[model samples]
Target: MSEGPGATAHRAVTVRGPLSDARASEQARGDHHAAPLAAASWLLTTAMDLHRMAGALAEGLTAESGDDAEAVARLTSRWTSLHRDGGPPAEHTRLEALVEIRRPRTRRPALLWQWSGADPVAALAASSGRLARELVAVSQAAPLAEAFVGPVVLAPETAVHFVHETLGHSLEADNYRDYAAGCGLVVGSTVAGPQLTVVDGPLPGLETSRPRDDEGHTSRSTPLVEAGVVAGVLTDAREARRQRLPRTGNGRRAFGAAEALPRMSALHVARGTTPHAELVRPVRHGLYCRGAWGGGSVEEFFVVRPACAEWIEDGELTGRFVYGFDVKGRKISGLGALGSVGDDMGVFNPVTGCGKYGQELPVSMRSPSLAFDRLCAVPIAPASPSPPP
Candidate 1:
């Protein structure tokens, strides 16, 4: 292991076993006919003597986790991609495995679990065993209910995506300096409900938790949003110096890669007094997502695909599986839609990392189940639910 974040810990050792990069791309796709997450087109690579290297690079990966099953499931979707780019020693002995679990009635709503690591046996066993259980959860699901395109009740596992995308990305110094400001995300302003509070810092006992940033600054909590207001922005040493702002220890970068930039470490969304189940008790014509396959954002538009969901009507879940549903909308619009926050908080230390400027870095997030309104829910084909009541 590297001693310091800035130190280039290049391993030049020879491998005698099967080792693969488990950093997965576990994003769920909306298409039924499209290639599954397992269809990673990996090319063979060879690294023997000096100046010799070979690998199987995977593209179009969905990002998964560990109590943190939500993170594992998400990163493992596109799990079989092994990188042999002759850059890092770990890349030379990488492996990827994807497990597909179908509901028997239809293939449209299949459960995918992917794993990657140096050891193929361990990776496969982990991915397959976990996904098998989730498949059972949706086994008795009603015939792929028709899509519901309205408000949503997101569980803690799914709620992290909401804050990570619309709110988390918005607080990045670069984002705030560029696009977010134009979208009305000004600092020191109330952007969410009074109950909503978001903080970015290193968490103890969490995987990939950085005690210090890549640039050698002690990691400290940076409040991005407090009581629904934009309280702080993440900054690296460079940005802090340039903007005359506090360097919040968020500077990050990939090893042997480019320079570090301001980034998020462990994001903590404070829990509310409301119970988790209560959020769904009032939804009459919406879907309740229990977990997410994966999610991301592009400027103002954000999309989070629900891996497992239930139909809610008459103030209770129907216990029916809702598949292929997408929660998407303008980031700014979703800010004020905080209906409720749950007391159950989830910590996600996924195998997959966040990407920006072509650099991917490992990160973790924590949040409670959050309820929001006004965001559109778009269910894909073959699993459409009935119209709202």
Candidate 2:
């Protein structure tokens, strides 16, 4: 079978007795050794099927784009042997695809889409549709009004990104070592209300789950925060050794990445007991941020642009607002302002790249609707009106 660039095949053989005798005895054992081989075969078949589906999707996009738009797509299929070091390797396969579209001679920003999952088709289609709708809405949207600062209820999806950007990245061991940043030094410090907890690990059945990291370390769930107190920080071998901290198995390397680093896999805020309705019911006047576009951080402070938001009045949604707003605050302060956490949660595998040290890795986050008190929401400069056509 054809493999992508950097793909490597691994094999191992064990003989309990002399080769001839072992083979004869194994044959008499009733094909017990065949089980692993069968499983590996099935995994390979699945990966090949996903590859074909990706190719078909690319072809369709190319035809639809015609010559006006340039389209580029790539599919990467990863198969890992879970028990490679043991009796027989357990095969694991992961598929990720990315599609980029740009209209030549136009000043519009290029649209990027990405997906990662066992089923490539469904993930790809969902990402493409979401990107298309977002682009259209952004292009047609009018200038927004001044943003209201204070209490706000973040949608589940928006909360996922917020927790990822504000907490996950800030807790990386490298960030702690390099800049003296992160919550590492603040272990046992209460950073939020008792209802807030954050976790990071290779959660099973998730698109980002894995048995081991790139450095051959076994994966385990690590609690970054629990009951509002700092619990732990993610660590790779180097950082763990330097800081004399236990490794959390967070070492990860991007495709074609030269070196492994401490990167989050499946990071999320644990769900709270608060019902979904009650989380927003107490909000008298606030914004309900449903989505986000671009965001980044400078040290402990962070900023994210809301893609779409609605006004909340009398503990209910008023209407979809058209203006852009910036959510800004220090990480710890933002968490400390948590009014409540909802029971309904949303998981997201983002298409936009999360860049660090010039390398981008696949990551996922999940969180319930979160309400914050005393946070700043400032209006962005109005978009320049389209030149009179």
Candidate 3:
């Protein structure tokens, strides 16, 4: 038995006593326990098989490692709310549930594998104090500067931030079909370099990583672009068959509500020979885009609200870009201005989800702190969709 993110343990525990059917019923019926929100807690005690194996593997993998990390403390909780709408169909009340997991450490215990039936708070409380302390230590000591070194935790929001802004929604087949609104940087027609490529997959161990898609399709690695050449788009079952291209396991939806599209998972641009220092060394004055608050782009126009940024002087990063400059430019020019690429990749989490055509899907995108020769900084503004045909 094993526990945590990479754990592979299987076991079950049963509690025999007075069932709380009454409490659950009361909560559902708007009684004393029935409120806008409801919560439950429990103490999960394993027979110690999973945790023991996890400890052994951790020792083997981290032998002589200098970096400090937390033990795996995965807290997956869900929040539900009732919705009533008046529309074409009829007036109805619907329940929506949101599930999330927070595995702060490199190693998680067996609790990560156990599901408590839609209740996330109880799963978190099951962990001991030792795990909590480890998480705290990792948070306090681990600086974002070390992001260039190894695998870092990327929540869903951040993952979507990278994908939507960097890769996922940008390279859709439809987007490139007839020079659609924001799809000018064609795969084979774009830039040229050995370091430049685009890849998407449902690789195991990633939050967006899944063995099969919603259409019962098996996952496979598909090259969106190879060394600046057009490879293909992230196609779903329909698109794959329509275009006569193999499915890339991209068909997915937001909890089975909306239709699937050519979504992305584990999307990234591979690293080049440039060291982290050299990647920024050539820049005498430039910007570093860490994350995005909000922005939009068209094939002719792309704008981004920088989460954080700093200035470069003689290859050294000065203080944060206090002038508050942001990134704005055309897709072709933007991609053309790229001076260097990093070897970093961002993975999926629960926070960020891709939204398109009234649907949202899971995704992740990776890239180094790319350097650009000259990036136009424009002010943010209210979004106005392009004029309809």
Which candidate gets the maximum TM-score versus the true structure?
A: 2
Q: RMSD in angstroms, all models?
A: 12.3, 12.2, 13.9
lDDT of each: 0.60, 0.63, 0.43
- 204 Cα displacement, candidate 1 (Å): 2.1
> Tens digits of per-residue lDDT for model 3 on 184-204?
555456554555666777554
lDDT of 2: 0.63
Which regions of candidate 1 fall more than 4 Å away from where they truly are? 1-133, 137-147, 380-389
| Highest lDDT against the true fold, candidate | 2
Model 2: per-residue Cα lDDT over 1-389, one tens digit each: 22221222322211121112221101111232432232434434443443343334333443444424344444444443332222243344444544454455454333454566655556655545545544444444444577567787887767877787777887888876664244323777788889989999976535676667766788789998898887888888888998898988887765455566888878878888889778667778877776566677667777877676666777886654554668887877788888898888766765445788887766777788899986778878758999997
lDDT (Cα) of model 3: 0.43
Any runs in candidate 3 off by more than 4 Å, and if so which?
1-163, 178-184, 256-258, 294-300, 323-325, 344-350, 381-389
Error of 2 at 86 (Å): 15
lDDT of 1 by residue, 201-273 (tens): 9776344466666666778988888888888989987788887899898887675564678888778899898
Sorted on lDDT, highest at the top, how do the candidates line up? Answer: 2, 1, 3
